[model samples]
Target: MARKVIESVTCDACSKKGLEVPGTVNLTVMGDRYDLCDEHGARFRDQLAAALAPAVDAALSA
Candidate 1:
């Protein structure tokens, strides 16, 4: 088993301060973890939704 390092300080995506601090969440994707602020986290969520929206629409239409 590989060791999991818990370095929850800065946002891995944007290097924003106060990552994984109080009242924050830790995001993990494809075995990679990320610590993002509220701003970046909302952006990520919107992006993911947008990415899936087209596919979902297509599937529904078909």
Candidate 2:
């Protein structure tokens, strides 16, 4: 059993004063978590989808 921890995170894609959007997007890659704002979150989602599309298509075709 492993213990889970949750902490506040600032958006990694933006660098502006008071621009931190907490509790927005929590993305986990290879066991590491990243928090992003709405804009960056959407971009990340789209990029992830595009990256996975090829593998998904191949899997479906097989």
Candidates' C-alpha lDDT: 0.70, 0.81
Clashes of each: 0, 0
Candidate 1's displacement at residue 44, Å, is: 0.7
On the 0 to 100 scale, the lDDT of residue 35 in model 2 is: 75
As for candidate 1, its clashing pairs are none
Clash list (residue pairs), candidate 2? none
lDDT of each residue in 12-56, candidate 1, tens digit only: 556544234332547888998877667678888899999999999
Question: What lDDT does model 2 reach?
Answer: 0.81
State the number of backbone clashes in model 1.
0
- After TM-score superposition, the amount by which residue 54's alpha carbon in candidate 2 deviates from its true location, in angstroms, is 1.1
Worst 10 residues of 1 by lDDT: 16-25
Report the Cα lDDT for residue 24, model 2.
74
Query: What is the Å distance of residue 10 in model 1 from its true position?
Result: 2.9
Candidate 2 lDDT over residue span 1-62, tens digit each: 99999886778666355565664787899999877888889999999999999999999999
